[model samples]
Target: MGTTLLGIDTKEHCFEAQFHPKRPLLACACITGEVELHHFDRENRTHELAQSITSHSKSCRAAKFLTDSILASTGADKFAALSDLETGKQVWRCKLKAAGYSLLALDTERFAIGDDDGGLRIFEGRAPKAAVSWSENTDFISDLAMGVDGTSLCAVSGDGTLAVYDVRKSGEKGLIAMSDFQDDELLSVAILRRGTKVICGTQTGVLPIFSWGDFGDQKDRINGHSMSVDAMVKLAEDSIITGSSDGKLRVVAVHSKSLHSQILGILGEMSAEYPIERLSLSPDASTLACSSHGRPSVQLWSTEAARRLMEGESWESIFEVPDEGAEGEGAKADPTAAESDDDSSEEEQPKKKRRKEKKKGKKNVPGSNAKQHQAAKFFAGL
Candidate 1:
């Protein structure tokens, strides 16, 4: 029961959505600057004239899908354009000084852009012009991902950091991995390949899970989203499929932090009148496409019945749980028996300091530091 999807309301500021890697069509963005492109079929209905179109004049933020036909859009006024998904026409616009949010096609002849200050240009061939190459935050730069061999790139900043550049090295060359939650502002990032693991999402409602080589304490930590997770999807090398902003959606399994399935929404259009942002999965993960919150009404899901109800525990042994003093081998000497119980607590500390001076509070005149500084200067110059 796959082919099904709907959502078309171009009200404006719809940020992103794209799928045409083989066309059943889907493309989005609206904040008035339009760029709609729905097309569903096989009973999955949608076709307001094969889906409308327009381009930045105001709010678009980002929209992608660069191969299998071509499409791109960005806004907030730094404009950006490329079209021709079977005759939409535009071909190129480029204004950029700082106004993209995030977009990475990285194929169909190079494509990458992440702005709103943290620049990161890269545009290639015909009418294309952009080349900041790399830059680093002062504010927005929501998300970027390209490293399946496009060399490298994985961004996420709006003040939370998560870089990792090295796209043929020049400036932002590194193993960059900064993750500070200070006020929590990451939003999203996913890189499950090379080395192994890197998933993030914040804005308070957490979903960490780092460890892609350097390792350090975070191989799992998902605290029931109260708001903000926006989207995530891997579905294989250990499964993953999140979405939050409270309209809830989950499938996590990261070698078992468990929660193998969940989906709730119904009435007033699934989940009390919208609130999800984005989510996509279907390169054979079955099919899932969602979007909610305002002009957010896109739906389609059924990854073969949630991957057969996520199979019940085996997410590597139901989220493994064995590392508190790692029991056995004398529990690694229990911190030296907790430092010999701090040497039997310094041999019971002077019998608890003379029973705490017999429970009193004001008594310190056992003589001379210049007679207690002359009795506190004779009672402060009374």
Candidate 2:
């Protein structure tokens, strides 16, 4: 089925989940400020609980893997903390002026944090001093992402600003550029093509792409989902996957060789009632780990197949689509859909069959986490 459910869900809601970059580790932060770390055993297809940490006093909104043995987390507690995953010990803690909402690891010794009141702070190593702090009248920062080079940082604000900071310089010099392409809140921001094109997932179901250094009018807008886009992860340099509150996971093509981007297909999906909470890619980019409210804490699937499907391959051509009718209880195998006239003039993917299916059934769900946690015993091939 190309899917595996790992880790048991706790009573408290899990706000974020991540997979380690260089280790076989999966971690999640709950509303109760509890951080759970697990070891994924690809050989046995099982996950073992590695540690449960109570580092924050309140909800841990964001968590990212810094190193194989280090994790960074922030929440309503108004502090950012680094913990040793091996021992589940709090190694360093830095208090912010306001509640922390987003966290991004900038480099080996520097990390960035976004807070309520529209604040963005940068810290170097364990020093308590904020190497830099900057913000305008923007509302709480909804998301933060570092450029592939770690030399630039991009942040989305509650008000609709997508700002990029050049951390290479200190003080106000670091404030590079910003764009308010749409008035609606931008829930997510991602840098593509090194730092040329910046994409933001807006509240209005659109992914607005802006050229770096000059955030004027958007270069293009990718119509994504019906609901607010809550999370996104770059699948390949030119491809991305988005999770929305409307309960859909979409694979969209970007930075195409022809310079045209479009929705490739849907990977995994859920309902609005339990929107996806987080999405993590394994170190090898082979397995994708996902989390959603009221569902399993972790869901796994093959990235290779999703990639093939993105290239316009068929379900059977990729793998079995999962037959639910024959099994009666488990996922039923879906009938192979008739090929569509992809020659439609509209650039948008057609929703003709989707509209019909929608009229036939009803459901809802939540989103994914990017930049995950780390731990021991690397996931040995899945």
Candidate 3:
């Protein structure tokens, strides 16, 4: 079956969309200061409106569902909100001195927020106390992602800095300061394979992967797309999926060095042509939720299709050009003459080819004259 837009809100301008960990529906929030919940059936690829919430005074940037039908959202108005999913009611909101950009639910009671003043704050569940707070940066944190077990946090700030913090430690565990590039902002981050490696997205279209717990080790940069990498999500233990401002979702196989990408655009532009803002994978590895800014679209992809693409045979033909089309194969493939040329070229070319190859090479060989003189002296001595 084909995919369908289950529902859309012209007023909300959805920026991020996330699914309930155990439920069949998804939730989203908008830059126009509203939140919405959507119910979907992937089997039929249909979406329906579940709820529309207007809780914040300013634009809401991030939202995620906690357990027990509870939701949490952050906005540009320096507030972190806790809501009831079924009732669409705000239970509590903790105010911060600076505007908050990202919300990560640690548990039903505790959550983490990255603020505009380059601060990382962890708030207690259902309480007013701060669990732990650190300001290791002087710039606003653009994106924050927690490890699978919630023991490690990866934060990328607006200053093009990426740092990982160990939450279990009483003091500091250390940090990996990533390389900065000109005219690029750190857009997003993700943890791979239970925090064994870290991936960071940048505005200049580079995805840098770092080994966990290895300070000062240079990261392996994966050059993927031509525009800003807005979101990255781990699909499996060995693979990742990225959504970009270029309106494409790319699955990168780290182990196999294979890539499967689809452009949802037309004429060398992102097809469906929306600016993809975020990506989130289901906990069971069955679905991918994509959120967009330009079209305010939330698209779900089949996890099985994603897995097949990741495990499929290599796609090396995308770079090659056939010498002849199938219609001209008979004229191009003189089987007997081609075999004879192969044998004759192999036998006749080696010695003659050596003289021609070394004509310009002998002068640049590192120690060729010294070795030759040494060999001559040894022969004379013998």
Ranking by TM-score: 2, 3, 1
Compare candidates 1 and 2 on lDDT and give the better one: 2
Candidate 3 accuracy as lDDT: 0.59
**TM-scores, each model vs. reference:** 0.31, 0.79, 0.73
lDDT of 3 by residue, 144-242 (tens): 877665666677765555656666542233232322222345677777755666777777777776666542223576763666677777777667777
Residue 336 CA displacement from its true place in model 1, Å: 50
The CA root-mean-square deviation of candidate 2, after full C-alpha superposition on the true structure, stands at 12.8
- How does model 2 fare in lDDT? 0.65
The runs of at least 3 residues in candidate 1 whose Cα sits more than 4 Å from the true structure, single-residue gaps closed, are 1-34, 39-51, 57-77, 80-96, 99-177, 180-208, 211-231, 234-239, 242-252, 255-287, 290-301, 307-382
In candidate 2, how many Å is residue 216 off? 1.8
Model 2: per-residue lDDT, tens digit, 296-339? Answer: 65566667756875666755445454555322111122222222
Give the alpha-carbon lDDT of every model.
Answer: 0.55, 0.65, 0.59
1 against 3, candidate with superior TM-score: 3
Candidate 2 lowest-lDDT run of ten: 360-369
lDDT of model 1, residue 208: 73
Error of 2 at 123 (Å): 1.6
